[model samples]
Target: MKTVFITGSSRGLGLEFTKQYLEKGYLVIASCRTPEKAKALHDLKMQYSDTLSLIQLDVTKEKERDRAFDEINEVFDSIDILINNAGIISGDGKNLYNLGDVHKEDFMKVLEINSLAPLLMSEKFLPLLEKVTNAKIINMTSQNGSITQRTQGGKYSYCTSKAALNMITKILSNDLREKEITVLAIQPGWIQTDMGGVNAPLKPAEPISKIIELVETKEIADTGKFLTQEGKELPW
Candidate 1:
């Protein structure tokens, strides 16, 4: 059976992805910042039983990251897919910032969480990822990352961080091109969630299911290209 490791598997899109992967019969290494505090993930662990394993990963914390790396390295020698779903948007609703008022602290934190964390995780998991016969890296990016999609730009922190993440995805695809791995930059789209908020047009599962389909497909010429959930090329 294919094994997948997903970060930020506590709630929202992460939780949903974990559920779907388990339903599809894949062994899921689901991670949350706080395994004991994540009631939902804890419950899913109980429901899925042995199919799902819960672990704590703050992503921002180096010690936690190291512990997670060591534990996964010891437990699972290979991971078929690694989903970098852990991300943050600092100024979503509160502390409204215009172009001039973009708080430095918030911007730095967003970049650290959304952009740097994934790279760190990938680096740590390289050995485990390489052990798999056909490994894939999925960077959970956003349409906001696309310069073409930026019409009304306000959330500077989120937009900049996600856009940087898009670049990182492309870079990963290029770096791993010679390797037997597929690195994809996927836009989950504007789905209703804590980040997307309610009244968003698309459902959370729509983009997620699309991601699963894209990951399983054969590698095409567009290795480092950015794409939407529907497999359409997104202008970066």
Candidate 2:
């Protein structure tokens, strides 16, 4: 069976991805910082049993990342696809004045978790990933990352981190091309997750199912693109 490693699988979009992939017969390595707190994943584990395996991971922690690499090394041959599904939003970034009032520490924390850690994970696991014939690294990015669209302009931390993630995606795409791993960024649309909020247009299921389809059909030429659910490439 094909294997996938997904970060932030404790809840929201991550949980959904774990559920869907397990149903499709892929062995899923689901990682979250707090495994006991992941009630949904806990329930799914009881039902899915053998396919879904939980591991402790907090991207901000290097020790955790190394431990995860060791775990994956022991559990499977190599990951066919890796979904960097972990992300965070500034609870303070709702309006303009809110940006000024935001704590610098919180902003740095978000960047560490959202932007830098994924790069670290990619670098650390690159060797193991090299074993897969069709290796893929999917960075979960946002339309907010689009330099072309500014909109109302409040979420400074979230927006800048995702934009940086896009740049990292491009850099890795170029770097990994010769290595045979496909590095790509995807905009999962405004799905109704904890971060996306209730008013968000589509449900998590909609964008996620579409993303899986895209991953299955992902082409060599599709690298470095900021793509949307409908298969249209969004502007970087």
After best superposition, candidate 1 residue 109: deviation in angstroms? Answer: 0.3
lDDT (Cα, tens digit) per residue for candidate 2, span 1-236: 88899999988899889989998999999999999899999899999888988999998798999998998899788888989989988634543324566667777877887899889989988987899886999999998888888677577878888999999999999999887788889889888888888999888887898899899988557777789877798888
List, in order, the clash count of every candidate structure: 0, 0
For residue 147, model 1's alpha carbon misses the true position, in angstroms, by: 1.6
Which candidate has the top score in TM-score?
A: 2
lDDT of 1 by residue, 1-236 (tens): 88899999888889989988998999999999878888988787788897898888998889999999888878786898999998876734463345867887778888898998998888888888888766888888888788878999587888888899888888887787777677888888888878777988888787788788888884735567678878888889
